[model samples]
Target chain A: MAIEHSSVDLSDAMILEPTALADWIITAPVIIPLIAGALLLMIRHETRFHAGIAIGALLLALLGHIGLLARVLETGPLTMTMGRWLPPFGISFTADVLGASMGLAATLSALVCALYSLTDIGARGRRYGFYGFLMLMMAGVNGAFITGDIFNLYVWFEVFLISSFGLLVLGSERRQLDGATKYAILNLLGTTLFLTATALLYGALGTLNMADIARVMPEVQDSIPAGTLATLFFFAFAMKAAAFPVNFWLPASYHTPRIAAAALFGGVLTKIGVYALLRTFGMLMPDQLTLLSTLIAWVAAATMIIGVMGALAQTDLRRILGFVVISGVGTMMAGLALGSVEGFSGAIFYAFHSILVMTALYLLAGVMNGLAGTYSLRTLSGLYTSHPLVAAFAFLLFLAVSGLPPASGLWPKVMLIRASIDGGAPWLAFAILLSSLLTMLALGRVFLLAVWRPAVEPSTAMVVSPGIGYAALLVLAVPIVWMGVYPEPFANVATKAAAGLTDTSAYIRSVFPEVVQ
Target chain B: MQTLIFRTAAPYISSLMVLFSIFVTLRGHNEPGGGFIGGLIAASAAAVYGIAYGVPAVRKALYFHPMAIAGSGLMLSALSGVFSIFHGVPLMTGVWGSFGFLGATVDIATVVTFDLGVYLVVLGSFTSIALALEEREDG
Candidate 1:
């Protein structure tokens, strides 16, 4: 894509005036973290300041993404091409409601994590680069969501993957190393598959821009192994999402990191996989997605069932939360499998919903660990008598995660179930209900054992959860509770995002205005 | 393990490679050479120097922590893109600047600053890793 310096007028296209302020909004989520993370990395000995900068960086990124989301919701998709090069030539960052909302949600969750790290992350962990890696991961997550090119998506994947690897083993504990080892091997495999799929798709279509590929998919479908390529993409994202049998690595490794790190991982890490699925299959290759819908539905059911069953078997609180994360992925996958406007909306809503709720759940796990000095459910008791507010927060978040009424999780689950029924997939509807029921049972059991039951023995050490820690949980809880109470505004955006994915005309039009069909 | 001839030749090779690395970085957009390769060459020069002398000597010569250099480069690379924001363009849009001095014109671009940042990051990270490995070996 070399620019031919044929004339001055042609050169003028290279430096168009930054009209309309949307251009800056399009790329700020990525660049802010890139600058802030690197700056944080240079200062090796200031935990207080490092945490402050990390929070500031994420807060700024979240604000930018909020602006981006508002613009996308008000108007349509936003596009920014690198070096002023047009699409199918230069790399582009394109954001629709789906990407914009995802970025904002991830940034919000990450901001909470950064704040919580102030009290939760020890000086040793801060010295080892907690905030730096967290910001680095946010950059990757936002980039993956916003990029219009498939290859750029893979590049962003690697960026976040490397950062996660850094965060996973930051403490260099034996268990952390062991968990990181497993995490690395599986994720690398997933990344390699993703790269392979991207390469093969590029070879088949001769283009890597997502919108370009979608536009050309019909013309090229007959010539290429489009189904297999789609499956390759599906397989890569499924493994990454920890859906069904491919999910072992998530449970094995996710519980090992520090809670702040784990909260971020639980919040947006798996959702990235789900987001990629939605972008590639829902928006970019709907036909291929339709072709593979049934198999995906079955996989989704299995992922939901097995994930909750694993949670039921786990006594480790953090470990149970990891399984709960896996089950939520199933719910998102089920939404993907439905392949309807409602289903897509449900999935989009669920991913953002899960990002907020699941992250808070993990942070709650940390706060509980701070209070009770453990992650094990067995030796913990009488949380209600001691910390009624913590118990109440736990109760609300559990209600949300398990898809009980009047919590954020319930809306997405209802949307998904309704979508499945409307889409004539009663079995999927049944599966969703059954998984939610089991999740409630599992979490209810946790509540009974940890919060309701009296103390098994007299407690010795009293480590009250830090003020910042509660503030972090409060920050996260407010959103979950708010979304639960008044979901119309957010749900409306989700509907639009789903619509944008289904019809990608606006998305494609944003990237290449002249090529709109 | 270093012989007299090897030690004597190392310094010349190292210095020449460092010089060539800068040339490569300068000609990066026009030619095949770029910041990444340039940085690799520079890092290799440092490694060779460390082999000839010691990690301590290389550290003294560098005068800054390798990670600090890498971090500065990251900041530079990121800020280079930020320049476009103030100028009213998307991030990474290449804006040009020209300066007239002594009846001569000098042109500069954000892309070059980005490349330089990439160079420093690569050089810093690789040199640090090399230093760490060599220190462990000497220990």
Candidate 2:
């Protein structure tokens, strides 16, 4: 209890008057998929219908998120509490530009993944609740991105985690079980740390609403070990984001699942952790973020270098992509470590870029694997001649992910590196540059060996994949190419989103508009 | 162990526990019991029945796949929240209604429906896990 807060508070902070009906769109992103997912459960065995239902649900969610982003951009920020309860007592959903854009990116990535699932998943997989898990996971991811309640954020984490556990083990393969085990143990530790930190945070601040905590953080900072709490949260989120030291879980397990599931994990899952870190530090406690920036910078450097190195050493295409995913995490973490508006904006932009490009890469992996009848690079070759269209898609995603020109990945990397150098961290900038080079090399090698090299005699005939898989990949690829070509609008959104995060006044005020006076 | 004495009494014990679970669920809004705890209690009843008899027997008695029940429970919970959208309020806003029967008022609320959904989810999820484990042991 901030005994000090209640005295000066607007006595009416706890009450509400009737609002416009259209305001309900705030929760539509989460609610849409949740209802659809639950409905899909009743008929879980109907694989034929599952893909359509999942796609429809995801499209609805994507539209809702697009609407939310547009609204937040036009307005400043939006806030809605569950059950019409007052702030601090009821869980609130705060949608600022950052959260809305991320939600939109996540929903779009998920929709593409769902579409890919149609080609990648089978009747047996569908019967086991593939689409249902995808929807539920999206619910969790979107909820976490936008929730204004820290405890509710934890709940959303569990929602996604449980659904991911289901997604990871969809095939019941030995490799999947082995991978899921590592994924489970480490992730469980992360959640436990998250919960413990949340409890301590609540104990320190006497509130679970995120904005109120920020409002009271300055006063509470002196008495509590905010650093320790921050460390706990950092580690928890780092593990989730697959940052270095605890990131082994991602590369180990992601490659084991269906490529569709892996795509979701690679593209959207770890980004949740990154989003949580940015939201907590950038918005909730800017001082702690500043204090911890040096250590974060070191982590960022190590992650970038190590992640790319790991990718270079892998021969399996999926495994190589897994490490590539980790490398992207390092780049985003660099953005956080810099702690500038450009840095945050760059990170946000990268995250959206990463979601689209990474998911597309994974979908391409599925397509390539389908055609080659394997994920092994050693036995695959001559795709340039045999499947030029598929090989063309692969080349575009490669350029995009490697931070090359004419692709979305280039802009964020530029912004982040420039911000790092400008912020007086040349070494951090160097690490990012080094990672980009190594990433380009590693991925280019994948293309050279798997797609362009002279024909290797096929041990087996290529598996003809469905056109839907290519469609899904195309959906994800367009944004990367378009955003690259038309960077001004998207870059503007990223900057606006970052501006909201670096200055917490707007975010906090969204939650407690009356507290401003 | 599926002993004779336990098997003989399992049915009656399960029935009583289920009845108590419903009581707990209904009273949850005003008291300590809610869908979560009530569900656990109901699940324990199912587990006890499975221990005395078998998974097939419990499955037959239940007459539905446990996961299906869980899924429907989720739908119900979501719909209860959506009920507020019809009233032009934020999601999960509770709406209250009352009916008169023989000059006595009967109150109904979306909150209870949400709680009941939670109860079913807990019951279904726990029962399925317990049944799966037990069935594996038997086989």
Q: Note each model's CA RMSD in angstroms.
A: 2.1, 3.4
In model 1, the clashing pairs are A18-B88
Q: What share of the true interface contacts does each candidate keep?
A: 0.63, 0.68
Q: Per-residue CA lDDT of candidate 1, range A226-310, in tens?
A: 9999999999999989988899999999999999899999999999999999999998889999899999999999999999999
DockQ (Cα-based) for each candidate: 0.57, 0.56
Question: Residue A312 in candidate 1 has what lDDT?
Answer: 98
- Classified by CAPRI criteria, candidate 2 counts as medium
Q: How many residue pairs collide in each prediction?
A: 1, 0
Chain A: TM-score in each model:
0.97, 0.96
Docking outcome class, model 1 = medium
Worst 10 residues of 1 chain A by lDDT: A1-10
Judge candidate 2 at residue B60 and give its lDDT.
94
What is the Cα root-mean-square deviation between model 1 and the actual structure?
Answer: 2.1
